[model samples]
Target: MKFLEENLLDHLQRPEFAELHSVLINHKFSKGSYICQPGMGSNQVFIVVSGRVRVYLGCEEKEFNLGILTKGDIYSTHTGTFVQALTDAVVLMTDVKTFRQRMVGDPEVTKAMVRVLGNILKTSFTIIDGLAFKDVNSRLVALLSNEARRHGMSLEDGSVQIQIDLSVEQIARLVGSTRQTVSMLLSDLVRAGLIERPERGKFLIPNLSALESVGGVTLS
Candidate 1:
């Protein structure tokens, strides 16, 4: 049998997922709305059908972004992370118990769930590693480099433009620094000819290799 697809959107077209699909409840969230907050007793699994959601952890004083889920990504709400819409969004969701039951009956689906959980674990470890080993500037550079690889559009002039869709404050949260610090670092980058801001919520890397060099980490 074919292994289940990673994208939940693809699963919607598969006969094997029909039962689970039938039970999915559709919900919409406006930008900055919380889909799941800590200690909310959330027990649902959700798939992002449209727009972007931010998974993060923190108290009122500080926050750390765990990951951003765009269309086709899946997550379980019971993971205790705060899930908030970064943009106006729609999601299809079902109770965790129902999803577990389906996984128990379907080996392929179980495999897919395992892969999803594995990715989540890997991301956690990466964050931990960055916190323990990297300084603030290094962490920010790594974040930008990774985002470029994942979401950038190449230009004819050998530059890569990333629609990062995050304010400097949000980026500071992701890199565990103050917004003023991040802003200064960004200015330094611009002066060093590493990056440019052509518009709000976007970044242009004139030389991705040079930017990656400053972080001293290999891009996989």
Candidate 2:
């Protein structure tokens, strides 16, 4: 997934950024590996070079997913959250002290940090709104619509085709619903002509308007 057009390295955009390459130690983790845990001594931040990771709260039985970080996403190792690799992944790890030192007197660095924090806060709010007010179906639609807007291709016929490779359980976990419920809802969407499963995992959204309608979204 093209999660980033420009990353932290690009944000700096200076000759000094070349120094990051030397400091960035590449690390590989298998799926299900714990990257970090709450209260663990974490003194570094991570930049995902490839693969996916999930930052969440709670334990194994019930997890409230805060966000999913794919390629180019950043996460602090010191966060009071459990981070696990959702897929076999490679990440760039650098000392937090060094990273901050590099940014010590640069206004651009502060702006970049603000931008990243702003996005995180926005995502947190969206999650809160969905959980507090939206029903399961609406939440699922919003989830799919968000993903579609990010990674889907728009066709000449006004349809959007997105490659969703996540499993039913994974999708359920993301929307804070049961697997059975999400599966039934997905079937309903197929029958309603709003979505089509062209392959096992991929989806084609025939009409974005229909999706928005079902999701109870009104665009001005």
Please provide TM-scores, in order, for all candidate models, with all chains considered together: 0.89, 0.83
Give candidate 2's TM-score: 0.83
Tens digits of per-residue lDDT for model 1 on 85-175? 8889999888998877765566655566677677667667777888899999899998888778765789999999887677999889888
Error of 2 at 53 (Å): 2.9
lDDT, candidate 2, 72-176, per-residue tens? 677678867788887898998888998776656667555655655566576677878888999999988887787677668899999999765567887788788
In candidate 1, position 126 carries an lDDT of 77
Candidate 2 — which residues are off by over 4 angstroms? 1-5, 11-14, 199-201, 218-220
Model 1 stretches with alpha carbons more than 4 Å out = 1-6, 103-105
lDDT of 2: 0.76
Reference-based lDDT, each prediction: 0.81, 0.76
Worst 10 residues of 2 by lDDT: 1-10
